[model samples]
Target: MQAVITFRQFSFRYKNQSEPTLKNIHLEIARGEKIWIAGPSGSGKSTLAHCINGLIPFSYGGEMSGQLLLDGQDASGMTIFERSRRIGTILQNPDAQFVGQTVGEDVAFQLENEAAPYDVMKTAVSSALELVGMQAYEAQGPHELSGGQKQQVALAGVLSTQADILLFDEPLANLDPASGAKAMRLIDEIHRNQGKTVILIEHRVEDVLLEHIDRVVVMNEGEIAAIGTPDELLAAGILPRYGLRQPLYLEALSHAGLPLSGFTDLSHPESLKPTEDGSEPQGPPILSESQLRDRLEAWSTSVLPAGRGSLGEPLLELRGVSFAYEPGMNAVADVTLTVRSGETVALLGSNGAGKSTLSGLITGLHKPGSGEICLRGEVINGWSIRRRGEEIGYVMQHPHHMLTQHMVRDEIRIGLVARGVPEPEREQRTEEALQICGLYPYRNWPVSALSFGQKKRLSIAAILALQPKLMILDEPTAGQDYRHYTEFMEFINRLSGEGMAFLFITHDMHLALEYADRAAVMSEGRVIAEDAVARILADGGITSRANLRETSLARFARAQGLVSPSRFVEAFIAAEKKVKRA
Candidate 1:
């Protein structure tokens, strides 16, 4: 196999940075191989990707050392345009990467830059859209697409260039499972059919590229930690130590107290089956109806209707809300919804369905010309932007948009100071927030130095410092992997228990199914239906209207004829316990 990307004792230090982000790293990626880079956040995974694509030393001013070769050429001497012609890079934020209004134009933007012929560019754009399964959306505006669709458009743009090596930085971030599966399939197809070299920088280790990955490369604190086959790495227990999840099937088996002797390969999906036909089942269901009901009741207790006789007071309400940036166009229309105290409601919808527009209206960032907004049982149509922030803390889909401070500690403290909190209490609260967000160690670190995941956590901490009654979080777990996702949600659950109401705007159906007390489906700028999570998901009308797909677990359960999907989580946990005992 020919080496496509090679880093020999490479080290890099950003401008004014005392320490190197990447230190004496040595790595080699062979041509036509699909590799997964997995590790804790701030582990130089993204830096490694940037180094390969000529962004590190060229675009980013940094002190560089050692040698880096891309396709047998020294990366140190290559211009960005020259490097880009050989490598296709899809960044973490697809929206930031998009350069054109329409999908077709965006895909063709790269080719046009290279001065490709009109016919050639057109054919490349068409083929790229087809490759990403977004051929039907070519005419749609980039802003009109959902988070997942935006990512796919960005991917199509990269593919249109026909670069031999594809570099993806958290490509699955903000995508729903179905779209994620599609993207993964496309990557696999590129590797198998096109024989392209691929490097995937991601945190999610379960199920995305497990079957297609040829090898695993783990990085920690700017250095390579370990590199090997998934089996070799998991058997050595290296993944969990760095907060990365092993394959769910493997983790589930371990949690279920199952013996590993019967399973030769933990990575194999078939390894999860019962080893013996007559083996005893796990102790009991993890979530009984009574338990689930109790949890639901507890959640609803704080926000239940104010009185049986009178319509409940709407903390925030929208009626006949319709909005679009231009005249004669509508992104959201006739949308009516309400959020009350102590309620955690999930906004569910497919790409381009206007959920984000609804969020902007509720937050007062965008006004609904056709409808009224009532806050605290009174119409707040006249409230200023500053006044809305006092009552509601809105966290955008991208944390960078909200972050304004140079240090994490300062970022958290700014909100407290603005809210008139006493200096002593503010300090105490800031410390507590940092501790909860697991950023205490990095309190004094520059905000720009933080990794994507850490920046997300810091954003949450900043919001927590304000202690707003209602928090609106958009795609809260967008780029997070299983471990971080679980940890972050656990924190949210704790806050919800403390009487904080949340309006969670998300595209992840699985997260909504697992965490939301009530699910509201949005379509064509309207709240088409609202019900319990299970009911909303099962309602064919709502599901179809929202363009929602069945969860991966649900699909797997149906394929295996399992009675309940929740049982799988419990069974897997039980298997893990059994394995630990053995």
Candidate 2:
């Protein structure tokens, strides 16, 4: 295969930044190959992706060295528009790239720019939308679509241009697990059929590896650490050291003390041939397929049981709440829920499922049409958003939206300073919040220096400084890799232990299963089921109805041929949590 994207001893330093974001990098990708780049939060993976599609030197004013080649040509002189003809970029936030209001207009924007004929542009737009299964939604507004749908429309725009090299930068970041999986499936199909060269920069490692990847490249601190086939890298057991997520199947095997060498392939779990039941068989000490499932089932049942002891008095309550932007159309309707003191409750549902609307009501950002909101038995429906902020801190879904200050410590201190906190105490609380959020080391650094995950922690720290009794976090762990995900959840779990309640509006099932005491599932503006996380996950009917999917561990257990998939799933998840907690 011919090299389509190449970087030779490349390095980049942002304006006024001492350290180069990408240092002495060298990477080459072949035409028609699908490669997944894996890295931790600040390892310069995004910078590398930006460099590939000619954004580093074009959009970002930066000092650079060495050569970058696209399609065997020197890309240093190419304009972003020139690069776009060969390379297409799909960003983490698809909404950022949306230029037109409607899907058809968005897809045809590029064709229109090229001055293509009306008939030619129409055919290209329709064909592109059809490829992503969005043909019927061409005339619909992009804002009217779900997060996943918006992403599909975004891809259609790129596809309409017929760009050969696709650069997807964390495309799954905003999608739910199931939706993420479907998006990956679509990308895989496009790659296979259209033969587009793909370089995907993502932290959803386990999910990305499910496709037929040509190679896997691992980057650490702006340098390529390793590159090889997926099987070689995954089975080699080096990902955990670099803060990258391993396939959950491998994690389960490790947890079970099963020798990983026994497997011929980890990707295709159906092709697995396990060891015998007892004695030293082909892979002894390792359970058979059925035995593996049984072991997982046992662990699942033993994990957190159906019901926790008793929760505290209701801290926040909603009764028959309904809201709408326009008459006769309710965004949130007849919703009733409660969050008790010192308990973490997960609010889960599909995109466009009124989760955000309900949260707006609680924060006093929106007025309830029919129902009342109470905080500690006192009606707070009439409260101002500022008044509610004193009692209930809200961390918006996008960290950048909440982050306003230029410096790290100042960002966290904003809340304290806003409410006239004393200088001495403000400094004291900001330091404590930074330490807890793991941003102490970067206290004096510019807010732009932080990673997406760090920015998220900064958002939390800002809210934590307010000393609110309750907090609402939306997709708190969306962009985090496994290591930070575990650390942040543990931090939140600890905070919840100290009388602070939380309502987590998230799509991460792992976070919900391990951190939340109970889960309230929402669908189409109604709370359908309220139960323990274990119960919610164990019941397939509720999961499917709520448009949620099982964790990879649960899927692994089922794939291993466990007798009872649900029980095994629960047990396996419990065991993993127990191990992590220990």
Candidate 3:
């Protein structure tokens, strides 16, 4: 097969940076092949994608060395418009790409730009929308759609362009597990049926590998660290060594002393078994079913369950609160919940399930139509946004919405200054927050220079400096890598221990499972389930209705026919907590 994209000793340095973002790179992606590029934040994955999609020289001025070729032609001189004719990019944030009011209009924008005939544009738009299962929503405005729906509209826009190569940057970062799985299936269909070259730039490596991938290219710093098939990398145990996490089941196997090299197919847990047809095994089987069961049982029993700490007094409360964007449609309906001091609560649900709206109601951004909101046993439904700000802090799902200051240090200290905090105390809090978020070195840098993940940390740091009684974070870990996510969560854990309350509205199941003490699941603007985090995750019925998927440990237990799979999950979590403490 001929190479559709080539990088020959390519290196690039931004005009504002002292070091090259990409260095001494060499790569070739064949036509019609599907490849995944993964790494931690600031690892040059985005820089490589920008180079391939014609953003490096055209939109972002930079110093470039060596050559990048598109379809056998040098690409250094290609304009973004010229590149768009052959390559289409779907950005991490779909809202940033919308140029039209409705779904149909957005999908037709590219066609209208090319001056295609009315009938031609209509046919192409309809076909693309149907392909993404968004045909029924063609008349809906952008604001009326959910996060996953907006992503589909963005993809429809790209598909209508009929570009030979499609690039997706962090497509799953903002979606729930079910929606992420659906998006992957759609991408796979497009790759197989249309023979388009597919390139995915994502930090969620495990989610990306749920679909088929021809190659996994792992990058670290500014250089390529490893490039091979997914199985090869998993067998070699190279991902964790380079700050990336493998699939959860594989990690569980490792914890159990089962060598990953013995597994031929690591994609599915059930694939670990020998073939039933008695054919030659692809790889050596480490143990029979009985032996595996015995080992799992012994390991699980040896690990004692951890105890939950006592929670402090109620810090915030909501009682039968209801609100509607319009007269007849309630976005938040009859919701009642509580957050206690020194406790961490997870609010989980599918897109359009009113999680963010509930947070807004608590933060005084929206007035409740009914019921009361209370703080420390006093009703606070009449509190002003600023008055509520003194006790509660909110970090929005998108960091750009929360950031106002130009420089990193100013952004962190602005709230404290507005609240009339003393200069010395403000400086101390700001410095402490910057250090906690690993943003100390970038304090003097412009906010625009930071990546999405860095901006997220900055947003959280700003909120942390306020020292509010309660904090509400929406999708806090969306763009972060594993290492930073752990460090940030550990910091949050310490704050909770000191008597601060937290409410997290997130789509990352792993984040909820590992951190939250309690979980409240919502559906159709109503709280449908509330319980301990482990119990909530163990219930398949609740997870299904809430559009959440089971954790890998739960799936692994079921696959191995464990007598009490939920207990197995709880035990694993307990063991993990014990290890973290040690």
Candidate 4:
């Protein structure tokens, strides 16, 4: 196979940094090969991607050496625009890259950049949009679209460029289960039909492996740790040590105490069947309800602290709230909800189901047209977003939007400084927040030098400095490596115990099941259901309707005729807790 991307002793160190983000790398990616790159948050995955896209030394000033070749040409000397024409990149934050107001214009912008004819651009845009199932949203503004929808539009824009090499950064970070599966299919189709080379930087390993990938390249702290085929790497348990996700199916099987030797492919649930060499049953064993229940109950008892205990008094309340950007098109409609002190509630729904809009309403970005929002029993409709922040804080999905300062310590100290706090108090709060977020060591580092995950931590630290009674964390775990994800959740759990209320808005069903005290589901701008997370996962009717999904363990339990969904979920969660979520 001809090499499309070649790295020879490549290394990069950002200005003012002590060490290189990428160090002494040597890698080769052949044409028409699809590879999934797995790594911890700051393990040089994104830095490597930047190298291929001509952003490292070009846009981000850095000390660089060695050589990176793309299509037999050196990538170092090429202009960003020239490299962009050959390598299309869909970044983690789709909104940041969108240049056009509407979907059609966004998709066509790439073609326009290429100076293609109007007719040719139009045809390419339509085909690209249709490929991503966003053809009907041609006139919708990117801001009006949901996070998942915006990501899809971004994918369409990249496709329109007709670049044979595509680089996707955390493509499924914001998508629901169904949308993510569809995206996998779309990318697979492009790889197969167009014969393009694809390099995907993703944390959702299990999901990406649904399509056929030629190899997996695992990175650890600026170095390649391992590279192998899916079966070889997964079966060898390569993900646990690196702060990455393991295949959900394998986790499910382990929880059930079943031997994994029977399975052929752990990546795809549909492909998970017994071996043909007469080793075990041809499929999942049917577990009885009582048997499954016992297993789950034992697991739960082992993992959960004596109990969820009594929840604290109500800290925040919403009464019949309705809001709209444009009259007669209500984005959040008549939804009444509450959050009690010492509770972490997972707010879940589809991409366009009004979760973000509801967050906006709660944060006072959009005033309610009908009902009232109360903080600690006081109506707060007149409060400004900043005024509300004194008692209520919000951390957005993308942390970059919340980060403005140049240094880590300064970023955390901004809120306290703006409130005219004494320097002593401000410094105290900043140090406390950084310590809680495990960012104390990086306090002196420039904010721009932090990786995406580190930036997210910085964002959280900024919010924590306020000491709000309640915090709404919107997809706080998106870009986190496993270590940070677990530690952050533990921190939240500790805070919840100390009487801080939390509303967790996220698409990760596993996170919801593992951490949420309760699951509040929204559908078409209404609170359709709210229940314990385990019960919510068990309720197929609600999950399917609202686009919330059952965990693989729950689904596996359902596959067994006698086992119940809730029972399997209990056992799975217990297993996770026993392992402290690996």
Q: Which model scores highest in TM-score? A: 3
Task: Report RMSD (Å) for each prediction in the order shown.
Answer: 7.1, 2.9, 2.0, 3.3
Q: Cα deviation of 431 in candidate 3 (Å)?
A: 2.1
lDDT of candidate 4 at residue 249, scale 0 to 100: 56
Off by over 4 Å in 3: 274-284
lDDT of 1 at 557: 38
| Candidate 2: tens digits of C-alpha lDDT, residues 1-582 | 788888899899988888888888888898899998888888888888888887787877789998898878899888889999888899888888999989999999989999999999999999999999999998898978999999999999999999999999988888876788889999999999999998898887766866788898888888888898887887787677788867666776666667677665666554555534445454353545666666555554555634353678999999999999999998888988889999999999888888988888899888999988999999988889888988998998888888999999889877788899999999999998888777788899999878777898899889988889999998888778778777767877777878889999998886787788889999888899998776677577887887787666556655666655556545556667667667
Q: Candidate 3, TM-score vs. the true structure?
A: 0.97
lDDT of each: 0.75, 0.83, 0.87, 0.83
Determine which window of 10 residues in candidate 3 has minimal summed lDDT: 274-283
> Please, what are the lDDT tens digits per residue for candidate 4 over residues 1-582?
999999999888888778988888989999999999998888999999988898877888889899999988888678888888899999888878999989999899967877999999999999999988899999999877877788889989988988889999998887877677778888899899999999999887667876899999999989999999988787778887788877665776666565566456666664464445444655443444455446645553445432475798888999999988889998888999999999889999988889998999889888898999998899999999888978888999888889999889989888897889899999899998998888898999888878777888889889988889999988888777777787878888889889999999988877787888898999889999988888887788998999866667666555543246675566566667767645
- Candidate 4 residue 197 C-alpha distance from true site, Å: 0.9
The lDDT ranking, best first, is 3, 4, 2, 1
Using all chains and alpha carbons, the TM-scores for the candidates as numbered come to: 0.81, 0.93, 0.97, 0.91
* Candidate 2 TM-score, C-alpha based: 0.93
Candidate 4 wrong stretches, greater than 4 Å: 256-262, 274-306, 560-562, 578-582
